[model samples]
Target: MRGMKSRLLTRREMDDLITKPDLPSLIADLENTPYREYIIGAKGRLDGILCIEAALRDNFTNTFRKVQDFVRQEEAERYIVIFLHRWDVQNIKTILRGKNIHVTSEEIASCLVPAGEMDEATLNELLKQPDVRAVVDLLATWKIPYARPLTRAYPEFLKTKDLAVLECALDRYYYDDALASVNSPGYNNQIIQDILRLEVDVINIKTVLRMVRDRVDPEEARRYLIGGGRVFDERKLGSMLCLSSIEDVVKTLANTPYRFLADLPESSIRSQKISIIEKELERFLIRKGVGAFRLEPLSVASVIGYFWAKYNEVTNIRVISRCKTADVSPDILKEELVYV
Candidate 1:
């Protein structure tokens, strides 16, 4: 783990790429790093954001495979599995959305990242489903575990025709299953627990904040709140949903470990720029994970930390590529990126 961590890009390397004058220069700079081979393969075939996304998917998936090789223990493998489960959830969500809109198989397949337990073949099969309900039914036929949540959420989907309800169910289910996997009696899964809880906390915070900004009913928003956050339990999250404003929400969090969220620019919130807060919260989680990585050295925390840092790099590169293609200003690009 130590040697592998050493090989990971330093903050300086990310800065060098970030400061590139244009998309071509950024792509060129990436060719000198671990992303080289992936970028090379994608060079002529794809351009702009598509090229960057392809390379990143390849890089991340390949790196995860390496982590699997590095960690031979069953417990460590389970941790990696749980970490990768998000990709499965995300892929399923993408397919559902595509099916809902009646997109063709090729279009749906293009949007998927086979970075989880689900392979390309399985995802392609999923693309064959006629609608979202059929997709859910397909999962059950395949005996995939995610089927349970999607199945349960299906009735609500039929009733309200709201994808958010179904998506929330899947999100909560993923967290519940993930926590259960790691929270075995007397296991040294504290770091895993902490990371997952922090994620839950962030998700809950974002949900509450969005509800406030969008004027969603407080009681209704409470259903989307996932349990098991280190802070912001059921009662607290409900309380937060009832808050009148982003400022009040931040103030409410002032006494919690997530007080840093209060530092989010209030002006942005006032101007309906809730995305800024969401972006900041994402960076905050990555930064916290990276800190744990450094503090814990060769432990699982470091591995998870490296995972986040690498993911952030991919995301930043993708942002730079797309922004450059769109001729977006450098200042705005910088604000969109997460540099720690």
Candidate 2:
């Protein structure tokens, strides 16, 4: 962890990258940073967003490699793998989406990030399947746990042709698996569990808000409600599902530990500009992770916090580069970013 901390980019470095005038400038700046080798490799082979994505993927691969290589504690390595599984879930979801749309294998391969358990070759093989169902079947054939939720969601996906059902099932399975993995009785593991629980809360809150906004039936909306949040158990989420409006949901949330959510503008939520709420939630999570890092410098919390910080930095740069390419004003892009 001590060695990993020094490798992480400082706030100033992130600021410098964020303020780059254009995508090419950003790529140029990356050449002088830890991503220099990836930048060099991507030169001429890729450009613009593709280049950035490739560099980020390579950077992610190296980040985990460095952590696992440096950390002597077997426990720390286990937690890191658990943390990285989210990307595995993401890669699978991307493949599923591509399969749903009948995209070519190359097109599907371009979107994958081999930052998790499944390597690039495995994901590419999954892409070669004839359809999304075959992809889901492949997971079962491989004895992967993700196949269960995906299989359960497949019939509904076929009936409704709504990918959200499948996506939600994936989310539920991922969080459930994450929470179970970290549920062992201990203080450091408890910290990781809390961070994950907060994540589950944010997902549940957003799901409920979107459902209310879309006028989804309460019973139908509850299907997306995930358990394991600190503030929201099955019963509490059920109660929330009974709320008539986003305003009511906000009021209900104000009585809970996540009262910070009340700070979000009800009008913005009603207007469907929920990005503000999402950003605030991310800021809240980042702040909590940082706090845990300070309180437990030698513990897994430090790695978790540094990971979130780096994750946010990467996300900010990606958003800035993409927005700059689209000629979005710097002020608007900065405003959308969470800087904890």
Candidate 3:
């Protein structure tokens, strides 16, 4: 067997460089590619993330077979290529989910992507290390503006398993770094700024909603609100706080560009700690939000989208199987599911 060489790529260009790759015509059939579209279109409902995730689990069966086929065809290194730095926050959450439920080390193994900057073994080590501080330390190798933000915010995270706040902090941290990295003086790349900022806008609204439901003070809520803006200015955030009931918060957000989540249940259920509805909402949007960013002819947007979608698919499968093992009814499962 010949040795396969990996190339240094900035997410977008890496797809062209995968070992024993699929042909241009084949990959181009992305629209006809059943699962992505299946995922993209399903984002309308509350369970849209679940639906995409279900589709991913169903599809991963095929991906597994493809890996099997790769070996049969003597192409052993053919696997999903991922950009880990961008999605490390999601990875941390997924790992945390597994550990929280007492999933054994070996059983929790396959869900990992194994590509990207962070090593799987290191991440697994993070799971067993205990507490969010350990998780932050394990990620010390990340070495970016994102790493520092999370590092700075870790003390607060250590104090609370308010998983939503922890999650919001990490996510808010990661994107802040991404935004900083992309903001070059010469390059007027509006697309890069747009995606990062829009993501922040979305997360801020969700965070604010959940915080309001939690009765978190406006001052405290400010901590969870890291960089990325233009949508969620002081005026909007203050206005959101002024609204009393969850219904009014929903209505107030509707008047803004953030009306996307206005349809989701804004009742106290939105602020749940354990279920952490924010992840479900975020996972769904990131997967199908192909056009929101301006990368073309297969670029960074596709790469980042793939990273988000891939993890959601893995996490979704994990949730479904857990439900299945517990013999949860389809109806109850459906209610909790981010369904395709």
Candidate 4:
């Protein structure tokens, strides 16, 4: 994991990629880094942002697999596998969203990263389903655990045609399962729980902002809040949900670890540009993941830390590549990146 972490792009390297004049230039520059092989392989059959994104995704998946292979201890591997299941949640969400929007199966397939317990074959099977209902039915037919929540939420999803209902179900299930799996008394288990709790808080924070922005009733919004967050409980989240605006909700966070949200530019909050707030929250989590390495170098924290660092590197590259394709200014592109 340390070796893999060492290969992560430095700030200067990321800056160099950010300044590339075009997609081709960015690809050329990437060939000089550890991503060279992936870039070369992807360039053979893809182009532009797709090419870069494919390379990045492939590299990330392989890197994570390498990390999994490195861990020989069963207990340690269990925690790592739990962490990897987030990708399953992510892949399922992507497929569901694609099916929701009626995108091409190939297009949806491109967006998936099969790095979790759900292998590529299973994801491909889900992709083959004719529609969202078919996908859910297939999961239930296969007896996959995630199918249970989706099955329960399917009727509500049918009534409202709202994908969030299913998405929230998946999120709730993932967190609950993860917490249960790591419930044993150990420092590593505690570390994993701390990270998961913060994640729940982050998700809830985003949920609150979205609900307030959309003028959803606070009572209705409460249904979407996942339990087991580290900081905000039901009372605290409910209080934030009752606020009239995103800025007001952020102000309610003034005393918490997320006080940084309150410190963001008033203009950003006033304008309801929640993406900036989301990015900051992500960076906050990345900082926690990275810090775990120094705090528990021999434990699963190091693996988690390396995973975050690698994930950040790939995300930054993808952002740069997409910006280059759009001819966006480097300054604006830098703003979009999570530098940690």
10 residues in a row with least lDDT, candidate 3: 1-10
Pairing residues by index, what is the TM-score of model 3? 0.57
> What is the Cα-based lDDT of residue 251 in candidate 1?
85
TM-score of each: 0.93, 0.93, 0.57, 0.97
Stretches off by above 4 angstroms in model 4 are none
lDDT of 3 by residue, 1-340 (tens): 0111121122332222222123222223222444555444444442422444434544544443343444443211211221245445566766655665667655555454434345556667776766556556666664533356557766675587555555666676677556675676432234556656776776666767667777777777776775667567866776676555556666775666646555565554445431344654564566445343344523344333433444444554345445554666645544553422
lDDT of 1 by residue, 269-308 (tens): 5676768778778988988876776665646776777778
In model 1, pairs of residues that clash are none
Among all candidates shown, the one with the greatest TM-score:
4
lDDT of 2 by residue, 1-340 (tens): 6565676667687778767888889889988887789888877698888888888878877787777677657666667887678888999999988988888888878777788888888898898899888999999999988899999999999999988898899988888888888788987788888888888888888888788767788888888888888888888787787777777777887777778878776688667676677777778877776566675677787778777766776677678778878888767777767676
Looking at candidate 1, what is the lDDT of residue 232? 79
Which parts of model 2 are misplaced by more than 4 Å?
Answer: none
lDDT of candidate 2 vs native?
0.81
Give each model's whole-structure lDDT.
Answer: 0.82, 0.81, 0.51, 0.89
Residue pairs in collision within model 4: none
lDDT, candidate 4, 1-340, per-residue tens: 6777888899999999988899888999999999999999999999888888888888888887877887867556876788789999999999999999999999998899988988899999999998889999999999988999999999999999989999999999999999998888999899889999999999999999999999999999998999999999999999888889988888888889999888789999999999989989999988887777786678888888887788788888878887777889989988888877
